[model samples]
Target: MTQVPFGDMKAHYQQFKSDIDTAVSRVLASGHYILGPELDKFEKDFAKFVGVNYAVGCSCGTEAIYLALAAMGVGPGDEVITVAHTAVPTINAISMTGATPVFADIDPVTYVMDVNSAESKITEKTKAFVPVHLYGQMVNMEPLMKLSLKHRIPVMEDIAQATGSLFKGAMAGTIGEYGAFSFYPSKNLGAFGDGGMVVTNSKENYELLLKLRNMGQSQRYHHDIVGINSRLDEIQAAILGAQLPYVNQWNTRRREIAKRYNEGLKGLVTTPQEASYGAHVYHLYVIQTENRDEMQKYLSDKGIQCLIHYPIPGHLQKAYTFLGYKKGDLPVTEHAANHILSLPMYPELTNEQVDHVIAAIRDYCKEKNTASVATPMSAQVAGR
Candidate 1:
């Protein structure tokens, strides 16, 4: 039996071993590990890639969001609106700011934040809107920006899963006031270890973020304001910088794999819908089926590894019970959480592996008696 892992970071390293090893060797020789030239180069290069005027390297995605919010002075007595369907780190970052994370439902088709639901969650205390680009798709930013302007609220984009995604030809992190990206080992442009970045066009925000990520040091331990120790280390910065050039190629491969999954699994499952407003980089190729748990088990038994992007919505989690959200508060989010399952996704996955996984899913659907109503790929496109 052939086994397919959800993501093979070791394989990824092996593929880029030469470059990664060289980067590590150079950084080790430099002996300047913290706040060094490598970090500066990567920040500038990443800012150029994202078409932003400034980019701040941080320890991780959660800190990226926290730094952005802190730069904007969002804290206690403030409210930040975001979706309940995203990674908990999104909410955790908001919580780190001492602000309340108000929940909003997601769009049924795109599975991203619904602008209308976000608008409804606003109040006088609403400080910012953090629209998470979940599963490599950018949210509809045009209307969201209009809403931001109308309500006088800032937009912070969570680009953890959307490193190279685009919206109306604009880069993912460039459209909002702040864009927070994660370079976790499994992302489209992942680092060898934990890393993150925050991009912005505002020089003021950029300067403040520099201070916030380094314990509020104005210059050499002269504390200016309250902050945290969240600087991106030299080694991780060098590794990410080396990987940055290949990000677009990797994203293209991910899209090609997604297209294959859509074609092969169309009728058997509800395939991901890419909104016309943006390109989906396919961070995780998710499918929706009524028997998600059973299918996951079947796939596991077949030596095909699978996982759920999220099995529980953030608002309904036990840790967030104090938020006062109940089971039915976010109907779409709650419903999708039960049905969505992520198939193995990575640029390095071969066609044979993808076909094997697809065959397993097709087999599962056929046995479950759900193939009779499988929809055509055309019919399953967005806005249907």
Candidate 2:
């Protein structure tokens, strides 16, 4: 039996073979691959798409986060608030900047940083906050923005999962002081390889971020400040530029697939929520379920590919346990780690594949229930 894939990058690449090949060959022929015209054009075009004044292209999403923080002047003795349920990269980016990452629990329903919790966790050392647009759903930026306004703290948005999402007519990346986007191959607006960019409305900050990504060189080998090397490659920029025009269209297809999944799995699992003010881009189509492990195994046995977005929350990881988070400290974040199962999702996934995955899940649930019923009722109750 052939197995399906969670992310079908080859299928997506096949759709733009000619343009991608041409873009790469052009860069190879130019012999000027690093930070060339391709990158400049991509930055400008992406900034316009996000409704921002400036964009600074960087090497990767993690690098982009660090650069954005540096540009905003966050460093040692500073603290930035973020959710612990997300990827470790978000928190590590802050730690790598010589700043402490103060984490709050996510909202169980929305899987986004709970603004109320975030506020309660702020302290004197708090210099900035990152409200991640987790799993393609925009965080409630209005409240966070209001909080930032009240406290005069800067906000850098982690919009890696929400490339084209919006909250109340404002784009996801445009609401904060700086918005960092990832073009990892699995993202909705993915590049061929690793890439990320930071967008900002502040001209000075944008210039600084640009400089920070290129070893602080205001000019050739002219070191302005201590900075790290992180530049987006030219070939990736060209590929991303070619695909930029069609990002919205692909996201629309993803939305349609999300709708089908919602309808198909209504009673079987807890589907992702769409807040009244925000649009969801369906990055992974993550479904919450109590039987995630068993479901994952069943899907594998059926040759259906599934994945867990994160089996371990960032705060509980061995790398971050030194931050003083003990088990059972964050109930919501822990619950999320046990339940999130990412279904097969991509813009190019066929309708038949979607239906097959849905049916497999339904059948698996039925079989599990039947097996449990076959056991003694008293034993089953005791097990529960």
Candidate 3:
């Protein structure tokens, strides 16, 4: 049996071994690890790449979102609206700001935040809208932005799974007031370890972010305001900078692989839907099936590793019980959590491996004697 891992970070490292080694060596040789020249250059380059005027390096993705919200004055007595279908980190970031996280349902087809659901969740206390770009696809931002302007609420994009995605020709993170990105080892533009960035066009927010991420210091030994320590380390900065130039190439390959998967898995399961508003970067190639658990177990037995992007919606989780959300509060989000399964996805996966995985999935459907039924939305997206 051919083993297909969910993501191959070792293979990724091998592909860029020399460049990564050089970056690590350079950082170590400098002995300036925190808030140094390497971080400075990476921040500038990342901002340029995202078409933003300023970028601030942070300790991790959750902190990136927290810093952006903190800059926007989101705190206790405020409400931040986002989807419950995403990784807990998205909600965790909102919770870290001492604000209440309001839940919204997701689109049945695209599996991202449903704009209508988001708008309905807003109240006088709503201070910000965080449209998480889940599974590498950008949320439909135009209507969301309109709502933001109407309500005087800020928009912060959680681009943790969508570093290079686009929406209507605009970069994912550039459309909102602030964009938060993660460089976890498996992202589209990953680093060797934990890393993150926050991008924005507002100079006021940018300057505040700088101080906030650095313990609210106006100068050495001068504490300007209350802040937390969340600086992006120099070594991770160097690693991310070294890999920055290859993001487009990697994203293109991810799209190609997605196309192959779509063609191969068409009627056997409901594949990811690429919305007309944006290009999906395929950070994780997810599919929906009725018997998701059984399929996952079968795939594992076949040496094809599979996992769930999320099996429990945030609003229904034990930690969030205090928020008073029930199981059916977010119907679409809860449905997706039970049905979605993530396949092996990465730029380095070979054609043979992809085909083997596809073949295994097809075999599962055949053995079960039932093809997964595509929902009305899925059928429309698939043009069936």
Query: Candidate 2 on 12-117: residue-level lDDT in tens?
Result: 8898899899988998999989989999999999999999999988988888888899888999999999988887899889999999899887777778888888
Against the correct fold, how does model 1 do in TM-score? Answer: 0.97
Pairs clashing in candidate 3?
Answer: none
Predict model 2's lDDT versus the native: 0.86
Runs off by more than 4 Å, candidate 3? 374-384
Rank candidates by TM-score, best first: 3, 1, 2
TM-scores, in order shown?
A: 0.97, 0.95, 0.97
By summed lDDT, which 10 consecutive residues of candidate 1 come out lowest?
372-381
- Residue 306 alpha-carbon offset, candidate 3, angstroms: 0.6
lDDT of 3 at 85: 90
Superposition error at 321 for model 1 (Å)? 0.6
Q: Candidate 3 local accuracy as lDDT?
A: 0.91
Clash count of each predicted structure = 0, 0, 0
lDDT of 1 by residue, 6-122 (tens): 999889999999999999999999999999999999999999999999999999999999999888889999999999999999999999999999998888878899898898899
